[model samples]
Target: MIKSVAHAMIYVLNQDEALDFYKNKLGFEVGDDMKVEGGFRWLTVYPKTQSQLQLVLAEPKEGPLFTKDSAEKIRSLIEEGAFGAGVFETENCQKTYEELVAKGVEFIQPPTEQLYGVEAMGIDNSGNWFSLVQREK
Candidate 1:
């Protein structure tokens, strides 16, 4: 049986831009950024407070995982904002939203009171949307 998740993949168009967005805008820390065989870059980022699960910033190219056609389709879908990254927990949704907005993060929804708590929807530089939530205690 699996104990827990160690990494999650987030497909991106450009690794450098994704790195800047996740690191600077969201304040995530870099876990691993290294070049492997076949010139593939293995980059991962995680929240500052939590480093257990790293988000792999992977660029979809014609490689082992996908064909040229599939890679193109995935890239197109990513640019169309059809994919969601994941929900990010925050202590204060409103405050985090304000900070992110000031840092050039695009938000489709402002912090609103949800059934569980406050929630806001934001889009990363790569057009992946994610929810910022503050759960009720």
Candidate 2:
């Protein structure tokens, strides 16, 4: 049975930059970073409190995940900021947004009240946008 999520992926232009962004900007901790067989680097990170799941910092190139053409297409999309990494929950959307902004994270939208929560939209270093939300209590 599928009990929980293991890894979520976000294709990046550079792994080192992504590591710095996620680790330094987003305050995520390194989960695993090692060279696996077939010349792939298995790099993953997780939120400080959420160690059960990892966010895979993928470089979608001509490898196990994509062909050359497909990789190029994905790279183009990422460069264009045409992808999203889904919602990330936070305890305080406004506070978190300010912290992230101070750390050089770019936000397309500042935190605002929504029916379900307070939300802000931000872009990762790879151009993937994600929603930061603090749900209504």
Candidate 3:
């Protein structure tokens, strides 16, 4: 059985840009940044507070995971903001939203009261939407 969630993949348009966004803007630490055998880059970043779970920033290129046609399709979808990464928990949704906005992050929805907490919707550099939530106690 799997012990724990180690890494989650997020398809990116460019690894370098994604690195800048996640590391510089989102304040995540890079767990790994090495080139694989077949010109693939294994770049992963984790939140500063939680280093165990890393987000693998993968470029959808024609090599291992994608063929040329499929890679192009995936790229198109990413550009169109068709993917939702997942929910990201924050202690203060409003504060996080303001900080991210100051750093040039785009939020589709402002922080609003939800049944469970304060929630906001935002798009990352790769055109993936993520929910920023502050859970109620």
Q: Candidate 2, residues 1-137: lDDT per residue as tens digits?
A: 98999999888998999999999999999999998777688899999999998999998788787889999999999999988877899999999999999999999999999999999999999999999999999
Model 1 spans > 4 angstroms off:
none
Q: Which of the two candidates, 2 or 3, achieves a greater TM-score against the reference?
A: 3
Write model 3 residue lDDT over 5-59, tens digit each, in one string: 9999999999999999999988989999999788999999988999999999999
Instruction: Note the residue pairs that clash in candidate 3.
Output: none
Residues forming the 10-long window of minimal summed lDDT in candidate 1: 35-44
Tell me the spans in candidate 2 whose CA falls farther than 4 Å from its real position.
none
The TM-score of candidate 2 is 0.95
How much is the lDDT of residue 86 in candidate 2?
78
TM-score of each: 0.97, 0.95, 0.97
Local distance difference test, each candidate? 0.95, 0.92, 0.94
lDDT of 1 at 85: 88
Error of 2 at 104 (Å): 0.7
Model 2, residue 75: C-alpha shift (Å): 0.5
Maximum-lDDT candidate = 1
Q: Which whole-number lDDT from 0 to 100 does residue 121 have in model 1?
A: 99
Per-residue lDDT tens digits for candidate 1, residues 3-122, read 999999998999999999999999999999998887788999999999999999999998777899999999999999998889999999999999999999999999999999999999
What's the CA error at residue 92 for candidate 1, in Å? 0.5
Candidates ranked by lDDT, best first? 1, 3, 2
